[model samples]
Target: MRRSRLGRFGSRLQSRSWPRFVPRFVPRFLRCLWPDTLFGRLVMILAIGMFAGQVLTSTIWFDTHESRTLEVPARLFASRLADTARLIALAPDDAARRALAQQLGDPKYQIAWIAAKAPGVDATSTAGFRREPIVQRVIGDLIRGVLARRLGAPPEIRLLEANVHDDSGKRGGILNLFDSPMPTGDFHVQLKLHGTGWSGWLDVRANEGQADALTEPHSLALDYLVRIYLIRFTAVCVLAFIAVRFAVQPLRQLAKAAEALGRNIHRPPLPVTGPSEVRSAAQSFNAMQQQLADSIAQRTRFLTAVSHDLRSPLTRLRLRAEMLPDPVWRERLRGDLDEMEAMVTSTLDAVQGIEITETRHEIDLDSMLEGLAQDLREAGHAVSIAGRAGRPVPGYPRNLKRCLQNLLDNAVRYGERADVQITDTGRSVRIVISDRGPGIADAALRERVFEPYVRLASKEGTGLGLTISRSIAAAHGGTLTLENRAERGLDAVLSLPRED
Candidate 1:
């Protein structure tokens, strides 16, 4: 039981701390490699997949083609050399030997003769083909095995020169073989005939051009590289970006709609367009918005009706209080009725404030604040205005005025004075109303005051002022917050987003 408890505790700890822990633990370089946006990450993923596929394809194809390229030429060259040696051994006379060499000779291979004492080099001669140790060794091994079987003895082989020419007087089937159909740099090999005091030379040339990338050095490597790395890879990235952009467009629209709905739940329904999944999401979001608007409307109607019905009863109570015989009793009952009426009126106002029916328009916030300050000053309240918004802000002017007026009233009533300042950023606007009076003692109660009927103990008037102000601010996609001043009093800040 204890072990299980420990496990559960560990799981909860990890779950709670995972978001904070991951960034510190993961390598910074790896984190930097990833892009922040969804589109960039999607493109990166697709590019990686394409690169991997290309590498795999190149590896497999090169392996298969390279084997055939190397071994096929080596095997064919060895077999033809063996056949030449065998025919020379079977010749009955010198004349017949010469004819055999000529008849057996072909475009890729040339038959020839070399004197035993000819002023020429052999396989031990260190030049060209001999300089390439691996190539020489492999060639020697392949030809020797075939020649030894045909000649019934280990044949003496010599790689005279990689590119031999016919400056010598000796002439034969392979003499002046430059005129023959072999490649220019054909390699020469001399095989010793034991019984005969002569040596036979074979000019072996590779029949095919270097075609495989693995076995042969590629001349077009740069071209292939440019085509694959620059052209093909770039094309793939561009296609992926375009495809992902289209895919994410609907998501962007959904997010924008959601933001607008937060400011005003009565926003028009979203269009059911785009792909099937996106259309479905849009339809569902539209339905949710409609449902929320309808619910708020229903509640507002109920509150309005209740307030109206209660007003009639309150009026009758006022009349009955006026008819009371004792003056003190009548005064007390009237006070009670007045309080009841004020509470009902405040509640209804709060409800109606949320159901804004005003059309939006551009209003000069600076002018509005100036007018408010002037009005308060004329009404014998200590109010001053400072700062200016250089531009107009988009909102319902009446609602915004009401929101500011409420805050100003609170500041004047409790704090004894009001200081209003308007700050306008192109994207948003902020109005700060400050006062020098005893702020709420309890920090927790600052937010609670925005709830219906909630008020500070010393403050008089309906508690719905802050609530109604906040509802108006929210309706305009704004916020209202209260903060205690460092020295004394409170600061009520109203922030609203500006129209694009």
Candidate 2:
């Protein structure tokens, strides 16, 4: 029970700590292993697939073709050497033996007599990544078996050069090619006669010049192996890259069109081309854009008409209130009439501001802010502007200026002072407008304050200022948000995306 409790406690502790530790560690490794872009990811996948395919192909080829081709020559050479030893031993004299040796010498196997002891055998040196010692061992075993059957005992044998050797008559460790059209080498052996002092060296090579279908050594050539893999892998990689690029082109165009539409709702619809899926997406996007434009137009016209129709009655009511006999009643009616008129005007202005048709241009926001600050200071408000955007942003000059003006007005009215700062992040610009004032008590009410006509108890505006300002910022592919400062006051942050 105690162990179980301990285990449970440990698990609970680990679970609590998991989030903090895993986020920092896992993402670094994931970033290193994973490709960042679509193109890179596709290429990486293709490379891995190609490598696996090559590995499988090499395994199959070596198992079936290479092993069979090399083994046949070793077996045949062993048999021939055994036959020659038998014939030389059967010959009556030296002259007769010499003649028999000459007769037995064929294009594939050559016999030469040598008077010396058998050379030392180094088994380990005979086999490696590039050398096959098993081939020589099999051949030696076959020769010894044949001699044992004929002579009643195995003859003394030494492997002078049982493995593949270059044209220079030396064992060329690895990656050495014999001078020929196809990679060729000699399989040689030297053995001593039982009673005679003479030792015979039997030289067996892979069939003269033309490698037969069964005995071809072309597969073993270093150049042939390298060229086949290099050329094949390179071609596969290029083809895979082209195929993947073509497949993702439609998606790239769709993303670009979406970004552009965000900047300007009036931008042209995407071209409905390419594959069936892409065409369907483009058609849907076009329909949605059309619907949104129609809805905005209809809403704008409704607001304009409502504002116009309400003005006549509001004017009449104001005039009638002024003529009232009771002083208190007359003043109260006049104030109500004035408030109604202000609401109508504010609504009309907000609607008009959002439906701006100003052309986009590269404007230096830093200069504009400085000029606006100077104007505000001239109007007897304390305004301080700090920090400047490094690059000009693409936007409507009039609408953007109006948006900034509303924010500055709000700051001065509520906080009594405006502090503005701008930061450029290459792709976007952030403008922070802060004021030292009584901030919103409820954090939830901060977002609700942007709603039209929803003024705070202490504020006296139509409350459409923030609503219109945010709309303008959004129309230019940006955002406007408000946050309560830790000390006192509210911070209004505006982010505008820069045109590349």
Candidate 3:
């Protein structure tokens, strides 16, 4: 029987060593940072998105907090400044007005008299109000509004300098990223005041002045920031892990089931549970497995029926041929009947070897190969054995023995001598059987040689030995390949995986 051309092509593609696909522009380090599993990628995306949202919301809250914390202090300061402006209007001279203004201020709220010259540069002159942080902008607007309301008219307020600082003396213009703690805010201002017919800029330095309130909230705010970040991050990560694992576990189980199905036709079907899509996939896989099993059984039954039916007719033909008078005709009939019997037996063996039903066990390859070589040696075949397996392999011993026998027989019959080498490669077991025959010169024929009944020469046997051998190798989850040797003959390499 000839195998399907498409199947042969698929096997060839699988056997050939093609270069793996990789992105040409991506660096190796970046590729390594990328997560390969679904759970990892999903968690990373969720964590990053949550963190970004937290950063945005924290900034808005920080601005609102700055406005509220400074509102009452700003109103009181404006009221005091309004009272001083009226008092200065009552002073008898410029000297007295300056003196009164200087004497009326406190440490936290200082007022001084200054004559306008070039109207000296302020911090905002270079720092630019457009570039003010959200916290600074909010507080500044609130102070200006309160001053205007108290003075009965809008005052020209110039911010000379401003800064916010924490108890640790770390100065910033706003709450740091994600509401880092800050205790106090100080500002220097040059306010334009009009009294009667004279107007001048009053220099003022002031700060938000709740000593106990500011100090107490510093620790509480720090604790709150830390707790919010830590708790939310932990919760998000834990929740993401649980959700992603639950979603991906079904996929992992499905993959393992598919892999195991290739090695065992009788493996149990997948449990149909999970989401609708997952359940549908499991059902489909179970159906495919059943179809494959039923098809194989039908093939086996059909072959058995044909073999049993052909035997009686063949025996009858053989008897009728024996009754013929001519010796040449009698011998011809006998040879034809023998060939027919061999073909049927070889075909059945080929199919049976493809799927072995024996339970796997540890087999000592060293002793098995030595015993096989010894038997062939006693039978007058020039077979040589070398090397060691070193460890036992997990496989069906009888089927394994049959595979080796076919390889050895092919070598001894074609090449006149067979040299077998067994080596344990740590990861796998390699058995190389080299024959001293005219090695197949046509590279194309070497692969097709494994196809059913494919023959390189007119040997006096059914041409199914290599086919049966390769089937046995595949059943054991191993590979059997043929290659031309360097000097002469051919090498048949059988590689069996050592790990699951």
**Candidate maximizing lDDT:** 3
10 residues in a row with least lDDT, candidate 1: 208-217
Writing each residue's lDDT as its tens digit, candidate 1 over 1-500 gives 99999999788768863333323434565556667777877888788789778877865444333333334444555566777777776776555666777787776577764434446635244355445344445545666777677667787777543322222322222223223222222346766653455444433343322223222124334555677667888998899989989889988889988987876676668889888999999989989998888898889889889999998999999999899999999999999999999988888787777666666789888888888888899999999887788788888788889998999988998899998887877789888999999887677898899987887777898888898899889888889999998899999999988762
lDDT of 1: 0.71
TM-score of structure candidate 2: 0.59
Per-residue CA lDDT of candidate 3, range 1-500, in tens? Answer: 25688888678767744333224453565555556677787787787678778878876775666656555555565566667766865776566778988888877778877644326733224353334565456666766787777767777887655555455656554543224333555676667755665656677777654445533456656775677777888888898889888888988998888876776666689999989999999999999989988888889889989888999998999899999999998999899899898898888877777666667788898898899899989999988888888788888788889999999888998889999988888778999999988898888899898887878665656778888788777766789999999999999999988765
Candidate that scores best on TM-score: 1
Provide the lDDT at 464 for model 2.
Answer: 94
What local distance difference test score does each model get? 0.71, 0.73, 0.75
lDDT of 1 at 342: 90
Range of the 10 consecutive residues with the lowest summed lDDT in candidate 3: 121-130
State the lDDT of candidate 2 residue by residue for 340-362, as single tens digits.
88888888898778775667889
lDDT of 3: 0.75
For residue 186, model 2's alpha carbon misses the true position, in angstroms, by: 14
